[model samples]
Target: MTIESESDHILFLSRDLLDDIELQRLEADKLLLKCSRLARLSGTDEIKQWIKLEMEGYNGSKELSDHYMSRTGRWTNFAERKGYWGPLAQIEENIRVQKLRIDVSKVESLSGDGLIGAMRMNRDAQQALANGISSMVAIRSRVLNMLHTFVAGVYYERQFAKVAESTFEQYKKDVDALIAAHAGEVLEKLPSVVARLQEGNDEAVSQALTTCRRIIDSFADAIFPPQAGTYNLGGNDLSLDANKHQNRINVYVAERTDSKSRRTRIRQNLSNLYDRVSTGVHTDVTAEEAFSLFLNVYLFLGEILHLGVAQTKDSVMA
Candidate 1:
């Protein structure tokens, strides 16, 4: 499949899955609220009073026990005094308390119609639904993060973080080699570039990429001497050529295998790198991606330098 098609496929898949997850999340949230309300409503005032008594460290009501044992419907022996008492009523209250216990216990297991006691609700289904919502939300978060980077066309940001640990070590070695081979003035500013590129901060990485771009431009200038100076000035103002940068890149591309060469690939990569470098310096660009782009530029510069050296040797021999 083409890259465009693949990207569209992934985008659609991510969006659809995220929509389903959001639906589940909403359902779970609604169920949770319903359960809470039911738990509250199911608790009778008497039950709350009983629970409050326990919460307040009251062992039990002594007067009720005394009145119950005496088989009196009054709070005391004084005929003029009256207080509520009924063995049947207390029995009925106990039954209601037991029913309340069952109703409250079902809160966690409640789902479908059982949420409202319309039908039996499977506890496992309820748990799975809740868990699925959580799992999907986490996945959705990750997918959206990647999609944001992808949609922005910042390919490196989505890719660099997923690079293997061993690959990073290899890249680190390449950086060290580049430093060692081009020490002194050629790479005087590059000692910390690799380190900064590896930082978690995007700003630092963008700075490093910018540094690499400058180094590449300077190296290109050194390799391809400007033709403007070669022409006689004739006492007229010697205006520097505006297309010198493009001319240098064209010269570099011309030295390689003709139409069959990967020169186009090089140019495209360089263009993307340049765009990203500009964005990195001026706006927010993920550091890892900036570093990845830096690696591409570094490799391209190395090839350009190698080719230039070869051509110089051939001319010397001639």
Candidate 2:
């Protein structure tokens, strides 16, 4: 319902936006195909009313320019000051005037490639249709890319939450620091998503990515959070039961028995899980691969918890 992250908002909105743009492009293609069909039926041997028909459709097609122009209306201020208005108006007027000039027969009079060109559609009408479609496509690609980045970041955080919150804070202070750094990276990426919505322009996407990368690069303090720790001998620390403190099947298993070898294996398992997920975070992995990794991390955190409990029991026995 309420999407908190701006990037997430864009990512979610993009699904519908792409559908609408693609639908418009399909409509434009159909309109052009109709023009081509009329051209063929009339024959290039003599000028027909195809051009007049196309101009009429261009004016009548409510789907063509309205959405794109409305979205990019703010940019029109720059487009107009740079003298784009004259060319834009000229294209509109040419299409408009052709509707009344049915008897002019200018397109049919032309021979060779000129005639071939008219057969496709009126040149201006073809261009207008193409521009509208291309602009929509460009926006779609950028939005899709933004969504990809946001999804990947979410994967990292979810995976991290499974691992980082598995151990007590006082026992593994460095691990908590690592989780804090990761939280900072995730937060840094969220604020710029508002700017992304203002204009889905190239510059906006680039700026958002750059900001996120800068924060990611700053996380040099710790790479991996520890999974196992002893009791909080120093009672000054806060005891917020995180993912680390809870959901540990290993800890439950360890409390039942005194076997030391199985506990060592649990410690090794936790270490292997951390290494695997750390690599996953720093590299490219498909969605399937990422999800598999998240499950693996979840299971391994439980093993880490078990190892921590076993070690604490052994220390008490000694």
Candidate 3:
């Protein structure tokens, strides 16, 4: 798989991991390696350390759980079977089975070979399970990887609180700011939206979609209007496209904000809202979908407006 950026690679790896997991065709060792890479990218020491431990497995016999460290088997001597340690103790001891030292490599080979969850090897499945090696592999691939939540950044064991805190609210804020500046018409139409939704007509959906388009177009107009010129970005003089709102937003936001993640948000929200609502629907449109369109129109406006705000603030300061 050829991927470009760090974020793209992360996204690709995660998608690949999830695809295999959901399909239940998981490559246990391969999944571990991807998870390890993801954990490293997580930028948290705790997550990294945990993944490291999982990949390395138990250090030595001392660290291995007693359950796996030794195997218990009942030994029988037919001649002396009766009451050697008395019936009760003898039965207890016979049933109890003596614990003997076992090699970690014996059970561990299952995981090392990436065979888990019904995937058997030369050894009997039940016998291999006795060491709990498959369980450890599952924990690393399925359990630990799921727990990491590297994309979200805050979860059972990790840091990156700042990124976690800013998720939806930041998106909402961006949309709100955009609406305030460029959605005057949409706002006026909003008073009728509830009634329109109640009527359950496709017309309402069209109206909602059109309103979204208007606001975004207005937003684009406000920030980067149609101009027959080029924007000199660093040493490159990139010709401006009158039609490509994404390009405009990218250049503009990239100029103002140092945060690549924030720029990503602006581009994503803008593209989704603009592309989704831009095209008219031929099939039946539900009031729920129309309401969703309306909700998205409002929420997708603010961050773009934030760029404008920053520009205004800078101008005033100058």
Candidate 2: segments with Cα more than 4 A from true spot? 1-117, 120-123, 167-318
Each model's TM-score, in the order given? 0.37, 0.22, 0.38
- Give the winner by TM-score: 3
The regions of model 3 sitting more than 4 angstroms off are: 1-195, 232-242, 310-318
| Candidate 2 weakest ten by summed lDDT | 217-226
- Candidate 1: 10-residue stretch with minimal lDDT: 51-60
> Could you give candidate 3's per-residue lDDT for residues 58-97 as a string of tens digits?
2223323222112111112324431121111222232223
TM-score of 3: 0.38
Q: Count the backbone clashes (under 3 Å) in each candidate.
A: 0, 4, 9
Best by lDDT: 3
How close is each model in CA RMSD to the real structure?
21.0, 20.1, 18.5
lDDT per model vs. reference: 0.49, 0.41, 0.54
Give Cα distance to truth, residue 141, candidate 1, Å. 40
| Tens digit per residue, CA lDDT, model 1, 1-318 | 333554344434334334444454333333223222322433344333332322232222454344332332223333544333333223234445544555554544435644654333445545544554443344334433332332333223233433554586786566545444543344665656777877758667767877876766665555554665522222333333533553465555566435534666666666776667766787776766776777676666665555555666878999
